[model samples]
Target: MDLPVGHIVTVLEEMGIFEDDSEPPFEHWLVGRLEGLAPGIRSEAERWTRVLRDGGPRSLPRREGTVWLSLNQVCLALLEWSNRYDHLREVTRDDVLAHVKTLHGHQRRDQPVALRSLFTWAKRQGVIFRNLTSRIKVGQNEYAVLQPLLPEQVERSVAAALTPAARLVLAAVRAARVAQIAVLVLDDVDLGNRRLIIAGRARPLDDLTLKLLADRLPTGDAGGRAPRTSTTPTRPAVPATTGSARRCKDRTPPLERLRVDRQLEETLTHGPDPLHLAEVFGLDEKTAMRYADSARALLEQDAESGFSRDTRQGGNE
Candidate 1:
């Protein structure tokens, strides 16, 4: 009853254990296991699978004395174990060692390491948590528990998409009386061929971000039920610098513009991306870019004065 390597490989192949590219076209684990199997062990396993597939009134295969398990069987067993112990606490190395020993009906065996390998596989696929804690030590082993990302961290991670200003605007819109925030849609705010979507009535956003939001918004009415008209708005005959801020005129003046002007300038000048710049300065994409461009231009025009230019101008710190 000596198992041949080829026969063992064949059995594993039937069980889908090997990858398609395996040299012998067997399951992934077959190659590694082949070393332990006696020659011709694989042919015997192949015969077993063939008999089962033929449905020739043969008894079902038994695992009692078998050293081989198919890929599907391994998966099924792990899944069943997971479901049964879904509420269990984090598994320490010792806990895993115990489970493997118990599941395989062995005592004082290398079950703990085996269980760890299985858990590692599951953890990589996000099926289970991989905690990294130094709290417990079993035979010189340490463990950690897996947990979901915190809400605050998640918010910070994606905060780049919604600039601080955008976030503020969103907050205002959500908190404002719905009646006061009517007709919130993307539109050409400056009428300079640049478009924007109005987000909140609490305060106005600069042009770059407004344009980005307007461009990205779904084209439709509220509730996503109505189709939007495709007509583009016409450009204004004359563009006006409607905002209160005026460019600096001094060859070298003191602090000028709003308190956040320096931060805004830094954001625009060196942000990794327009969107990133917007988030850094709390402005939207278009406004962020526009501000960056404007800042550079204004500073260049007044380059003689350098960065520490005219104070008392609007937004001057």
Candidate 2:
């Protein structure tokens, strides 16, 4: 449970809690004292969190708000997880690794690094027995896995949409992801060839899909104003400036519905080649390949299931 600093301060002030020759009131209250964090460990984690809040990571300093809160959130969560343990020596490397994986599905880069840095600092401060961070490694993020959709799902998702995004999502399965789809300019659409040239790669757009895009194509994109730039299809950097620290993202239509279909298409048609995926999706080869591998895995699973079903049917017959 998070004890609010203001609430605690008010109660202490009202009750006339004062510093004595032996008991320090302000020093004790200022630090978040709880049963979970051991004495030295608690002070170190709390102090590091305060340091991050003031500036940035000790290793990589850019802005204050960008990295501090997330890193501190991870730090706080770690402290909370330690429970009644007196020292970080009780928290194993595996324990910290598992905690890192749970952060937004382990799809981020900085938070894990930040957590590792905390552990390193703890080790240097003699709070922990060893630097557990040396054992933990954060991997590259994987985007959405493409799964082949049944015909009915495609029809229903398209029918459910009020905007052109659903049809685009369906087309994206063969071509790219939503960001790539969003970047499509009118000049890129080759209706005559029934395909679009994206990143110098020709991806076929069927006539019906072409007509759908034509109907909903933004005038800005058509007039060569360029599509709005979107963050890469992974967790992005936190905004440094003060605002809500979060944005209210408006839903972009049947896109939500069409993602699975799109990825499946990318897999079945394009296979799991990261370079090709990068060209199509406008992602770095590594990120693109991650998606490709996921698609390939889904395809392999589907194939295995189909083989098992056929074998069972043959046995029954």
Candidate 3:
């Protein structure tokens, strides 16, 4: 069973291991643990242990707990695959790939990151001539299919929103994610120009969105001009909007789903062009392509169903 690094460190401290002046207690303990391994493997593991302990030349310093966690993952990988090679320098890209394939779920994803960190530091330190894990890719590729919410569902959700802030969140979902909405400040809103700067990109505000924003803004003075404040207030937390959606009588989709639905609507209005999606939503190329492909597939399916319906009608005539 695995124990936390803190527990292990406390136990070691109690044993008076830290009293020694020869080397750091953690490094000494790590080396002692790897004593059963081959000399070549143990030597490389020790190098990594020291590198992690000291925080390598190019890397930012990490806390003691973080250092131990990272070192644990890297050391485990090295020890497990020790039989395949005598030294880390002898390990090739194929060796790294083979090791990574043995892991499952989060381990499969995170082990590569640990390996990259180790090899990158090793290369910079001249311990290894090349970073073998540089080209290796992990994690999922295909995006999950997002079903757009119906127009009636959106209408009900809008009507159900009780607070001006909640309404603002619902309106902003057309352009920004929940995270972006949560961080929105008064400076990001341009009521006079009818635009909102979302994630550093200017999104044109629709009339409903504009009205919702106006509802949230402070009331004007007796002369009718809006009062200017020295400091801007941030929008409400994510829970504010999510709570509003949860309170709806009918099942309203989460903010993210609503955002996807809005994107699909945009694709339907314009065309399923990745470039257009990227510019409008400020999404990366890969994400834009995924959305574009999803929209295109949806359009094709609709066309096929329409053609089938036309054929059935002609047969009936």
Best by lDDT: 3
| Deviation in Å, model 2, residue 206 alpha carbon | 5.9
lDDT (Cα, tens digit) per residue for candidate 2, span 247-310: 1122222443344344435545667777775665566766566677776776678698774323
Cα lDDT tens digits for candidate 1, 27-68: 444454333333333333333333333323434434422324
* Candidate 1 residue runs with Cα over 4 Å from true position: 1-33, 44-149, 160-217, 221-317
List the global CA lDDT of all models: 0.36, 0.53, 0.68
What clash count goes with each model?
A: 41, 1, 0
TM-scores for every predicted model: 0.20, 0.45, 0.57
Q: What's the lDDT for candidate 2?
A: 0.53
> What's the true lDDT of residue 56 in model 2?
43
Q: What is the lDDT of residue 33 in candidate 1?
A: 39
Among these predictions, the greatest TM-score belongs to 3
Q: What lDDT tens digits, residue by residue, belong to model 3 across residues 186-294?
A: 6667777767788888776655566667776765455432345655355332335655544532446666666776676666557789898788789899888888888
Q: Where does candidate 3 clash, by residue pair?
A: none
1 or 2, which is superior by TM-score?
A: 2
In terms of TM-score, how similar is model 1 to the real structure?
Answer: 0.20
RMSD of each: 22.8, 13.7, 10.9
